[model samples]
Target chain A: LAKTTQPISMDSYEGQEVNITCSHNNIATNDYITWYQQFPSQGPRFIIQGYKTKVTNEVASLFIPADRKSSTLSLPRVSLSDTAVYYCLVGDPYNNNDMRFGAGTRLTVKP
Target chain B: SAVISQKPSRDICQRGTSLTIQCQVDSQVTMMFWYRQQPGQSLTLIATANQGSEATYESGFVIDKFPISRPNLTFSTLTVSNMSPEDSSIYLCSVEGTDYGYTFGSGTRLTVV
Candidate 1:
């Protein structure tokens, strides 16, 4: 399992683009960077995942560098509803046992 | 993606009592994961429930404290034994979807008094 490091909290205004960066210096060859969003009292929802380069989805986008040591999750046009905790995890997709979460970055989308 | 339905959405129990949380999935999955989330904290994987064998627990969690039962591929149960104030948290069940992404339940909030 790879350990991830991210900011403890971030503040952004509505309609702005928010980018949360995560560092996983010890990422393994088979590791993939995944991001999740969690609202109060709700389970975390999958946002985006990427191995390298960039991957985009209907909800968010993930960008990974060549080193695969770090990744970023970009949320476009933030809203108050998007204010939640974002978790960055790195693990082998095939191994469910290694799905561990790090201290997530709490993004506060203020009006 | 698989849809999960967890029962007892929220419960208030006395210390030393037990509460069982049930997880039912719409589809058959090879494995289901149980997680615990403390207040303002990230999730902690408690155990992996397999169809026909014992669950594999993570460090700091024990079967005696959190007994799990996986009778089939679509359903499982987690019993929090002898609850304490610390046991009050959100317990969620998750399964890996066909895309290898996790689909989580709404979670059961347990409040021990």
Candidate 2:
């Protein structure tokens, strides 16, 4: 399992783009970068995932560098409802049993 | 995608008592997982529920304290034995999808007083 480091908290205004970066210096070649969003009292929701370069979804986008050491989750036009904890995980998809989540970065979308 | 549901969305139990949280998925899944989230803290993986076999627990968690049962692929239960104030937390059940993403239940909030 690879350990990830991210900011404890971040604040952004509504309608602005928010980017949360995660550092996983020990990421493995077989590992893929995934991001999850968790709201209060709800389970973590899958936002976006990518192995390398950029992957975009309706909800968010994931950008992974060639080195695979770090990835960034970009949420465009944030809203108050987007305020939640964001977790970045790196692991092999085949071995789902060992996936783990870190402390996560709490993003507060201010009005 | 799988739809997961948990019973007893919230419960208040006295110390030394036990509460069983149930998880049911709409479709059969290969792996089911249990997790705990303490207040103001991140999620912690408790164990992996295996069908027709014993569950694999994580470090700091024991089968005696958090017993998990998986009779089939779509259903599982986690029992918190002899609860204490320290046992108060949100217990969530999850299953990994074919896409390698996790789908989780709403979570059962247990309050031990």
Candidate 3:
């Protein structure tokens, strides 16, 4: 199992870009990086997933380098509603059943 | 994205009692996952449920304490048996999406007093 490390919390202003990075030095060959957003009293929702380079979605973008040791989740324009816990997970797509969640970065978007 | 409906959104149970939480997915999935989140903590994987087979629990979680049943491809249940205050947490059901990520149920907030 690959363990991920990220910041405990972050602060961002509305309309500004927010980047959350996660480091997983033990990432495997087939492992992919995924980010999830979770609000209070609710289950997490998928944000973006990427294997290499960059993958963009309507909500967020995930950037991974060649080494794949770490990745960053970039939110284009954060808002108040975007304030939530963001989890970065590294796992093999084929066997993602064992993926564990670490204490995610608590992002607070200010006006 | 698949939608998941979880039953008993919130329940307050007495100690030593058991609470069974149900999850129903609109579409069929190969694997269903259960997770627990304690107060001011992160999510922890409890088990993975596959249809017509025994659930695979994570380390520190036992079937006797957190039994899971996946009767079909689209529905599964997780029972927290002999509940204690330590077991009071938010239980969530999730299904891996066909393409990239996983979809999660609304979540069940369980409080054992």
Candidate 4:
């Protein structure tokens, strides 16, 4: 399993753009980067996933650098409801069982 | 995506007692995962349940403490035995979806008093 490092917390205001970056220096060639969002008292939901380059969705955009060691999740026009914990996970297609979720980055959206 | 249904959404149990959580998926899945999330914390993988075989548990988790059973492709159960206050957390079940993602259950909030 690839170890990921991310900020413990982040703060943003409504309508502002929030970008959360994650680092996984030991990412394998077959590993994919995925992001999940978790609201209070709920399970984590898939936001976006990418193998490399950039992938955009209605929820968020994932930006993977050329080095593939780091990725960023961009949430445009944030809202108070977006306040939650965000997790960056390195997933292996062949070995998904070993994936782990670390202490996610708590995003606090203020009015 | 696979829709998961878990029973006994929340419960308050005695420290010496045990609680069983049931997860039923809408579709047949080969592997189902069990997870534990402490208050204000991230999720920890407890075990992986596959049909026709014993579950593969993660480190720090044991078969006796957290017994898992996968009767078929769509249903699984997790029983937490000899509970303690530390076991007072949310227990969740998940299955990998065909969308290259995972679908998770709403989770069982267990409060061991």
Off by over 4 Å in 2: B98-100
Candidates 2 and 3 compared: the better one by lDDT is 3
Fnat per model, in the order given? 0.68, 0.73, 0.86, 0.62
Better of 1 and 2 by DockQ: 2
> Which scores greater on DockQ, model 3 or model 4?
3
Output the better candidate (2/3) by DockQ: 3
Error of 3 at A106 (Å): 0.3
In the range B5-63, model 4's lDDT, one tens digit per residue, is 99889999999999999999999999999999999989999998989999999889999
- Give per-residue CA lDDT, model 2, range B1-113, as digits (tens): 89998998999999999999999999998789999999878899999887989999999999999999899989999999999999999999989865747888899999999
Error of 1 at B91 (Å): 0.6
Worst 10 residues of 1 chain A by lDDT: A91-100
Poorly placed runs, candidate 4 (over 4 Å): none
Name the 10 consecutive residues with the lowest summed lDDT in model 3 chain B.
B97-106
lDDT of 2 at A34: 84
Off by over 4 Å in 1: none
- lDDT for position A9 in model 3: 99
Model 3, residue A19: distance off in Å is 0.7
